[model samples]
Target: MLFSFEFSPIAVATLTFLLAGFVKGVIGLGLPTVAMGLLSTVMAPAQAASLLIVPSFVTNVWQLATGPRFGALARRLWPMMAGVVVGTLAGTGFMQGSHAGQAAIALGVALMAYAVLGLTAMRFAVPPRAERWLGPVIGAVTGLMTAATGVFVIPAVPYLGALGLPKDELIQALGLSFTVSTVALAAALAGGGSFETGTAGASALALAPALIGMSVGGWMRGRVSERMFRRCFFLGLLALGAHLASRALI
Candidate 1:
C-alpha cells in the first residue's frame, strides 16, 4: 500500500494522473484540483496531497518560468505570496491534528465552489487601487484553504483573473500564484510530518503519466471544443465533490 494507506491502488493513481494531466493540457490548469478530487476517493486528503506536491510544483514552475515579466509580476504579487505562506503555516494544525477526516469534507466543498464558479463563468474586476490591500487577504485565505484541503484554486484564481492582465501575463500570473501555493502547501505538509520519502517517490512516479497525458492533450487542443471540454470537466468536479462530501458524512 502506498504511504501505508489501506487502499492505495497503483492503477487508480496511474489513470487519475493521466486524466488529470490531460485536462490540464487541454486547459491551462486543474491538475491539483482534479488529482485531489479523484485521489481522495481511495485515500486520505493528506495522502493525496502528498502525491500532488511534485507534479504540481514542477508544472507550475514550468508555467512560471515561461513568462517574460517575472520581476514585475513578482513585485506585484509578493505580498500575496507572503500571506499565502503565513496562512498555510499558521493553519497546519488542521492537517496535523485529529481533523484529518474532516479535511475531505472541506476538499469537497472547495471543489464544488470552484466548479460552480467555473461553470457559471462569473467574472469580477479588481481595480488597481484595491489590489494593494486586497491581495494579501485573498492570498491568506487561499493559503488557509490550501492547508485545510490541499486545493488552492479558489479566491486566488478568481483574484488573478480580475487583474485585467493580458492573456499571456494572466497565464504567467496564474503560474506564479499556483507555484507559490504549491510551495506553501509543501511547507505545511512537511511541517505536519506528512511529506515523507514514500510520498515523494510516489508523487514523482506519477509525473510521467501526467506529462504523457498532457502531451497528448496538448496535441489535441485545437482540434476539440475547449468550451465544451471545460463544461464537462466542471460537471465532473461537481459530481465528484458531491460524492466526496456525502461519503465523508456517511
Candidate 2:
C-alpha cells in the first residue's frame, strides 16, 4: 500500500501517537492500546502495529537502560524474552493467513477485557510457582497478538499489575517485554512476505510523534494519583475496545 500522507491523516496520526506515548510514559504502560485504537481508525491494524515497532523499541531501550531495578530486570529478562519470541512466532504464523480485520477485532476485545478487569475492585494474587509458568504464557499470547494486531501487550499488563510489583519494576518489565516481542515480530514480518520497504518507511515516519507522546505522558505520571491514572486508562481502553468491536461488526 502506498503510504504517502496527506496532511490530515498525518496530523491525526501524530496527535494519536503523542497522546498514546504520553499515557505510556506516565503509567509505564498503555502505549499500544492508545496507538492501536486511534490508528486503527485510519490505518490497517498491521500497518499501525508496524508503525509502533520502532518507537516502542526506542522508548523501551531508554526505560530498561535508565530505569531503576536493572538487577531484577536482568534476572527476569530471559524467561520473558523466551515468551515474547514464542508468542511472536505464533502470532506471526496466524497473521500470515488471517484477516487483518479479524485480528483487529480480537485485539480490541482483549484490550477491553483487560480494561474491565483493571476497573474491578477484586484483586487476586498469583502463586510464585504459577508466576513462573504464567509469564511465558502471557508473553506468548502477547507476542501472537502483537504480531496479529498492534495492541498485543494488553494481556500481560494486568497480570503484571496483579503481581503487585513496584511501579518502577512493572514499567521495566513492560519495556523489556515490548522490546523482545517487537524484535520477534520484526523477524516474523521479514519472513512472512508482509514486511515491505514502503510500510517500514511509514512506520519510521510515525515514530517521532509516538516518542513525543511518550515524553509528555511520562511527565504526567508524577502529577496524577494512581487511582486517577488507572481510571483514565480503563476508560481509554473501553473506548478503544468499543471502536474496534464496532469496526469488526460493521
Every candidate's lDDT: 0.88, 0.74
Writing each residue's lDDT as its tens digit, candidate 1 over 148-174 gives 999889889999999999988988999
Q: Estimate each model's TM-score.
A: 0.96, 0.88
Candidate achieving the largest TM-score: 1
- In candidate 1 the C-alpha lDDT for residue 29 amounts to 91
Q: What is the C-alpha RMSD of each candidate to the true structure, in Å?
A: 1.5, 2.3
Give model 1's TM-score versus the native structure.
0.96
Strongest candidate by lDDT = 1
lDDT (C-alpha) at residue 69 in model 2: 85
Off by over 4 Å in 1: 5-8
Per-residue alpha-carbon lDDT of candidate 2 for residues 1-250, written as tens digits (9 for 90 to 100)? 6466678878878888788788877777777778778877787666667677777777778877766887777586567568878878766644445587687787788778878887885576766777778877777777777777766565666666677778778777777777777678777776776657877777787778878877777777778896888897888788888888888889
Candidate 1, after superposition: displacement of residue 210 in Å?
1.3
Candidate 1 displacement at residue 39 in angstroms: 0.3
